[model samples]
Target chain A: MSQTMPDWSVLAATCPSRTSLARIANKWTAMAVSVLGGGRTRFGDLKARLDGISGKVLTETLRDLERDGLVTRHVFAEVPPRVEYELTELGFTLHEPLLALCRWAEEHIAEVLVNRESYDAR
Target chain B: MSQTMPDWSVLAATCPSRTSLARIANKWTAMAVSVLGGGRTRFGDLKARLDGISGKVLTETLRDLERDGLVTRHVFAEVPPRVEYELTELGFTLHEPLLALCRWAEEHIAEVLVNRESYDAR
Candidate 1:
């Protein structure tokens, strides 16, 4: 029933998920989302969990995720204005696939690196 | 044993495949690679199989795939100078995942679209 769209091939052909995939699959996004997946997490804690992400990028990615409906942002009325982020249902559905991709990447890192070297020499 | 790199989390967090994923997961790259996967295909033939891809983008993607060692390019010595492209072993490894992603996209497209609408309205 839902297979009638024009962009269907985009996912089937290239993995339509590629577009938003970058958001969660990105270096910061993945870590940040993963951290949030455990439960709602504060921005500062997320920053700490994901080492080396700049405040600017973190804020930007979070905003993007929120905009895309993948993540929900909650702001508490308190001193310093406490804020938290958590995955929406749609975002949660991506867990298994994202985890699988990660595991695959981790398992195949050596091979991918080796391949990269071989490819570079060519 | 291979989970020692700093970038390990990138795949685990976001999906390391995101980088090369874009190459194969792009509109042109996906269709082109899929067509090439069947066997070695001429550039014009691939262009035909994948509708709407410009000659410029197709050439560029093929070049990128070749540079990344995902696809091999063959040039035949002939009056017309025949050329062909096909996936390398590494590129072939992506078949299952890529197919799965595409299928998922096709299957869940309506939901994604619905979600998109809802998101946009918010």
Candidate 2:
């Protein structure tokens, strides 16, 4: 695909931006980005922090983030090899918005729960 | 469940906030809220603006948003009975972040596509 358009819009159904939005809008992606914002973390450590994430799911999320140029994985040469994952410069730009979203969820859960109960009652 | 802790963390495995995040972090929910930010829109109109959304998915997304108290549904007493959807006060608060995420996707898509191509080649 050659680049002709100077702008992309998510509202456009066929726009590739929708695919990007789909990836980043995922709950696991949000949490992973939020956690990785702290600093570089090993795969196991990342999974542990995310809580309830299956190893496979966490690996896929990280791989997707890596493929998107958002996260980088590093391997250290040693008798016992170690791996670490960190946000790239581009990923850092994403960190703020995603973290803001996580904060929003946490801050508003009380009201959302109340609403769910009432809505379910009706 | 009784309320005790003041803080709700999505990082916690079983926190209700995760459920809330899971709901709002959905791509369809994000798109729906972004479009609804314009003002009240009929169901068909909302589906149209969202682009590529099926009627069933759009209906379910709106219902979820309504149940979460982030959206309000109004039914007009008319010959045919018209219905429209609008963001509630709480939903308005969600608008900024979700829209930001969508904008990020649009703005960063070129870079992401490039990254995907390069990653896939490896």
- DockQ leader: 2
Interface RMSD score of each model? 5.2, 0.8
Per-residue lDDT tens digits for candidate 1, residues A8-120, read 55423255554553344344554566567688989998887766667898899888777666788899999989999999987686555545544554555556656667877
For model 2, how big is the iRMS in angstroms?
A: 0.8
The list of candidate 2 runs beyond 4 A from truth reads A1-4, B1-4
* CA error at residue B119 for candidate 1, angstroms: 3.4
Query: Candidate 2, residue B119: CA error in Å?
Result: 0.7
- Model 2 chain A: worst 10 consecutive residues (lDDT sum): A3-12
lDDT of 2 by residue, B1-122 (tens): 89686778999999999999999888998899998898999987888888898999988999999999999999999978899999999999989899998999999999999999999999
lDDT of candidate 1 at residue A119, scale 0 to 100: 70
State the displacement of the C-alpha of residue B83, model 1, in Å, after optimal TM-score superposition.
2.8
Least lDDT summed over 10 consecutive residues: which range in candidate 2 chain B? B1-10
Residue-level lDDT tens digits of model 2 in A1-122: 89686668888899999999999999999999999999999888988899999988988999999999999999899668888999999999989999988999999999999999999999
The 0-to-1 C-alpha lDDT of every candidate, in the order given, reads 0.65, 0.92
Models 1 onward score TM values of 0.67, 0.94
